[model samples]
Target: MSASSPTVPETDPVASGRPFGAVDVTWLALLGLTLLTWIVGDDAALGLGRSALLLMGLATLKAVLIAAVFMELARRGRMLLLGLGAYLVVLWLVLWLILARG
Candidate 1:
């Protein structure tokens, strides 16, 4: 017997007017955020303490996005994603406090 080919839906976003899907959008966002972080790190004159905190905050955001989107944890493992996101936020806060105190 001949195998039937899988049919593509006519309403698919790629097939329609939209070029980017959720993953593509997420990737672009990550790229932009990375560029912003690089710029902030290179030219942020907000003092060492503030700069460190800002960089850490940006890093935490990137980490959460990567884990949620690229890792597919957001869809498949809500609890795990939440836990990781919470942990990242807490770590960022704790580090910022420590750096600020010093």
Candidate 2:
């Protein structure tokens, strides 16, 4: 997820020398990702397991965007990183338990 996310600037755009459109592009990307997740999750042909995996991936992507851009954690401490890692782990565990059938 972080692989696709843009690194947020540590300082204001004026100081960082980035254009104002960067924020707008991030906002649009978040919205588009959310919509895509919703659409893919609702596709019956994807079946349960595939839909779950795809949705989980999308959710992680959205989370990354929120943390890195909206929350400004690109250059922050490690707590946020730990929190996100824990969140994905828990999410995968729950999905495994629910999707795995003996």
Candidate 3:
């Protein structure tokens, strides 16, 4: 590569001139939420069913966050977001049906 070519450095964002992006903030928030969810979901006082539901809800939230931020669904056209939402709804319905049977 030529010296003049733009090089993507592996430095931290704080060191780089670029400001922190929304995706970075969303990722960090998701990480914290994941940790908190695990702690709360694992608490013995909540009981198995409630804990499982809480974990499941957290998982769903994480999935949505990843889709919106990392996948750039938030900036994408409404139709694309709608399609993704529909797909997720279908997946959730199928998963619910399967889990309900057990």
Candidate 4:
């Protein structure tokens, strides 16, 4: 009610309705990733190191999907977006180093 404070409209784009198909697709992708992780469990075909790498990569991909679509973090916040990018890079690098070591 303060004159100085800015008020956001109820029709903000973020709050607007989204096409239902997009949500369906995101849900399917999440389910597929879950099945993939389960399928990769205790498999010797790729060996231990490579399997670990593959699993970690899938995990990162899943995280990105959830963050971007489910959490809707992709809509705004530049610094937060940059943080997600940095997180993915640092995560892979750490995994790569560990693989190299062991």
Model 2 lDDT per residue over 14-96, tens place? 55876664557789998999899889977999877777777887777777777776776655645886688678758965885
Each candidate's clash count? 0, 0, 0, 0
Span of 10 residues, lowest total lDDT, candidate 4: 6-15
lDDT of each: 0.85, 0.74, 0.72, 0.73
> After best superposition, candidate 4 residue 98: deviation in angstroms?
1.0
Candidate with more favorable, higher TM-score: 1 or 3: 1
In candidate 3, how many clashes are counted? 0
Higher-lDDT candidate of 1 and 3: 1
**What pairs collide in candidate 2?**
none
What TM-score, to 2 decimals, does candidate 4 have? 0.69
Task: Enumerate residue pairs that collide in model 1.
Answer: none
Per-residue alpha-carbon lDDT of candidate 4 for residues 1-102, written as tens digits (9 for 90 to 100)? 689864553444445655454457888998999899888966768776777787888888888777776766765455676689679867976886688567
Best candidate, lDDT-wise?
1
Span of ten consecutive residues with least summed lDDT in model 1: 5-14
Question: 9-33, model 3: which lDDT tens digit per residue?
Answer: 4453444766777778998999998
Tell me the RMSD of model 3 versus the true structure: 7.5
User: Which pairs, if any, clash in model 3?
Assistant: none
Give the per-residue lDDT of model 1 (tens digit) for 1-102.
347854545654546667666678888999999999988989857877888789999999999988987887876688999999999999999999888877
Query: Which residues of candidate 4, in runs, are more than 4 Å off?
Result: 1-21
| Best of the two (1, 2) by lDDT | 1
Task: Tell me which of candidates 1 and 4 scores higher on lDDT.
Answer: 1
lDDT of 3 at 25: 92
